[model samples]
Target: MLKRQEVKIVGMGGQGIMVIGQLLAHAALIEGANVVWFPCYGPETRGGLAECTVIISSDEIGSPVTSTPDTLIAMTQPLLDKFAPTVKPGGVIFVNTSLAQPPKYRDDCKIVEIPANDIATELSNPKTANMVMLGGYVELMKPVKLESLKASLKEVLPEHNHRFIPINNTALDKGAEVTSR
Candidate 1:
């Protein structure tokens, strides 16, 4: 697996889209990689678009953005539709099939579809769908250690929110289970 990664994560507001970006950033930092987390949000606070780009590299990074990412984590159908073509050839795309229909046209890249929302619901925390997607990506590509991401939850989440760590960890583990060979 490559240590250098450029990832784009997308979902609606309040879906922990930015949280997973931060988790990746922190996980990269923990692994001693240069990293950047760039977030973009739509006008509406909770229902509109929420997305971010995460760059992780062992070498010094020149930018936090990428037009062609190594991976795409699409938490919604609209985002999957819009960004699937932006992934580079042989790259990976993780789609939340609970909401987004599978892409029918592209065959250049590997597509891993996980019903993240359904998985999260099974875990009793719908908010961790983003983490589910992240977990699967981490399991498949190993951009960072799974333990690093587990350790990063505290840093990415607020102190008052710490109580949810166990569930989040479980969600991540469940996600990994789905993709583990």
Candidate 2:
């Protein structure tokens, strides 16, 4: 059986870190997995630093906060410096290459650098980096099915933005394809 996975996504303000947590939680819920979503509320909610954690488990979750994580997705430079040390050994680290560069340290964990923001910009939506990363995570982690993710997106995204779903789905597929390599 696949073990439950804990993921921590850290980024500066306006990076959609919290949305990533929510999306993961929703996807996990659809998968019939126990889910916990936690976000770090700060004065910089607008221009300050922000972070969110999403814990997906096969069993009941204990707490929403996580001091350690099975996976770390650092979307900014500060986030990379702050939470990179907390990632567990053999865990996966998905770094946003657009804002945050790769870390210098050599850890035992697997690290993948993705230009999610660039891809999102090319897709004509700068805010779609989170979705791009989500797609990449699905491919890299394989924690949940892509079909499940698409269904959740359809349910969660507003109806007026329905036209953008296919574009976002393509972004996800692109991200996943690159990460799968």
Candidate 3:
């Protein structure tokens, strides 16, 4: 188990960036870890910059803001450009290959390219791209169990949208499948 882990998820507004951070925080709480989730976005409701910073640890957190993340998930090219340098050495980065290109070669961090939008499109729900990236992150990091993430969906998603649970679950599984290889 990680003593502490800081993550930053960045993408355009309306891409469910906040949801991914919330899901991770909820799962961490369920596992008895302390978590802090902070979201920031531009004035525009959509097609604007949005990002969430999530810190999970077994001990009490010192601060909610993250200047250097242990893990960075970039869902857009602009996000990738903005946050790639902020990842600490030995950290990992997950890039949405469908919408953004990987950063220039960097020996300080590991980069995992994921075609999240393409994967979600193949799943018939492009909105699920965030969930796919989250799934891959879970599988690669093993910070929380897959089952715990599944269970947290009920709490993270609103009641009116409960019917889409199965599709999101499948998206998570598909993402895990990609990372396991």
Index of the highest-TM-score prediction: 3
Candidate 3 residue lDDT tens string, 1-181:
5669899999999899998899999999999999999999989967899999999998899999989999999999998999999999999999999999988766779989899999999999999999999999999988888888899999999999899889899989988888888
- What lDDT does the true structure give each of the candidates? 0.90, 0.83, 0.92
Per-model root-mean-square deviation over C-alphas = 1.2, 1.6, 0.9
Residue-level lDDT of model 1, residues 28-77, one tens digit each, is: 89888889999999999579999899998888889887999999999999
lDDT of 2 by residue, 30-79 (tens): 98888888888678538677888888888888998878898998888887
lDDT-best of 1 and 2: 1
Estimate TM-scores for all models. Answer: 0.96, 0.92, 0.97
Off by over 4 Å in 2: none
Residue pairs with backbone overlap in model 2: 44-48
Off by over 4 Å in 1: none
